[model samples]
Target: MRNIKLTIEYDGKRYLGWQRLGDYDKTIQGKIEKVIKLMTDENTEIIGSGRTDGGTHARGQVANFKTTSEMTLEDMLAFFNRYLPQDIVVKNVEEATERFHARYNATGKQYSYYVWNAEIPSAFERAYSFYYPQQLDLARMEEACEKLIGKHDFIGFSALKKSKKSTVRTIESISIEQEGSLLHFSFVGDGFLHKMVRIIVGTLLEIGAGSMDVSAIDEIFENKVREHAGETVPAQGLFLDEVYYR
Candidate 1:
């Protein structure tokens, strides 16, 4: 069998999520797998780098599947794009080594959250960004971001149920930029727990609004309590920007 890797991008407006559920073909993974089944006549199983929550878009999502088809990489890419929906596009496709697993081999990931900080919404960007009009203190948010740029147990910021699995993760970097009424929060990390990025952004928003102090992050980390963190923000504004493997 040959391993095929795909670089995909999608607008997550209509689907449930990336994971395939039984025979349910409404999800992103199901949609792509359906197209694959039609093309190759094999019940191909595509594995994504990670599971993105519903309404979360992806610009550089990576997926891989093992197939016995003899189609060339170029033809495979063209075939997938021709048959897939316009919103979900296969940006690139190539052959991978036999042992190349998308999820297990990932080294790091970068996620971005967009915010529309305007009183009047933009018709163009309303679908991609979260609308929040309240005045925010950007300096405080930056300070909080500085504190989060290290390895820590982020169980308090995740929505995952109790598990023995490690909740510790390393945040590589954070960049918060504001331009006009648009605010972008970018985070690079080794890995994230469930809803970790959205929850971290929510806490930063609270800090920016002066509702939560910057030191609250320390308290949340020390106590390992989910309730001490801010609310889980909406998923529509979150994007899987990139995944790295090395």
Candidate 2:
């Protein structure tokens, strides 16, 4: 068996997220698996680094699959791009070692959330950025970001009501930058629970908007209360920027 690794980019506007649901043809994984079967006549399961929620996009998503076919990497890339939908693109393909696994071997990931801060929206960015016309205090948001850095139990910021697995995760850094009318928030972390990034962003926005205090984060962490966190931001503005492996 040959282990193949793929670098992919996709606009997740129409898909039901990255994982393949039972008999669902609208998932990114399902679409790619179907094309792989057509090319190699083998049902291969592609393992993604992680799942991106529905309507979330990706710039450097990584996935791997094992196959018995002897097709060249260039040929496989060509075949996938030709058959997959226009919104999805296979950026690169390569052979991997036997023990390589996309999700388990990942060391860190970078995710980005974009917001259009202006009252007037951009025609081109309407699909890609969240439009929040309210004025935000960048200073307040920066303070909140400082509180979120480093390792902590992030269950308060996630959607998981209960899990036996560890909820402790490390966020290496959180940077906020504004370019013209766009506000960009970048998060580099070891791992994130479901809806964690979105919830964190929402909380920060609330703090910046003066609806929530900066100290509320500490309270949420101490009490592990989900309701204390802000609303889960829309999925359209989130992007899986990159996945890293050591």
Best by lDDT: 2
Q: Candidate 2: how many backbone clashes?
A: 0
lDDT of 2 at 141: 98
Per-residue lDDT for 1-246 in model 2, tens only? 999999999999898999999979999999999999999999889999999989999999999999999999999999999999999999999999999999999999999999989879888887888888889999999999999999999999999999999999999999999999999999999999999999999999999999999999999999999999999989999999999999
* lDDT value, candidate 2, whole model: 0.95
lDDT of 1 by residue, 1-246 (tens): 999999999999788889988989668999999999998999988999999878899999999998999999999999999999998999999889999999999999999999999888889887888888778999999999998999999999999779799999999999999899999999999999999999999999999998999999999999999999998988889999999999
**RMSD in angstroms, all models?**
0.8, 0.7
Q: lDDT values of the candidates?
A: 0.93, 0.95
The local distance difference test score of model 1 is 0.93
Model 1: residues with Cα > 4 Å off, grouped in runs = none
Runs off by more than 4 Å, candidate 2: none
Each candidate's number of clashing pairs is: 0, 0
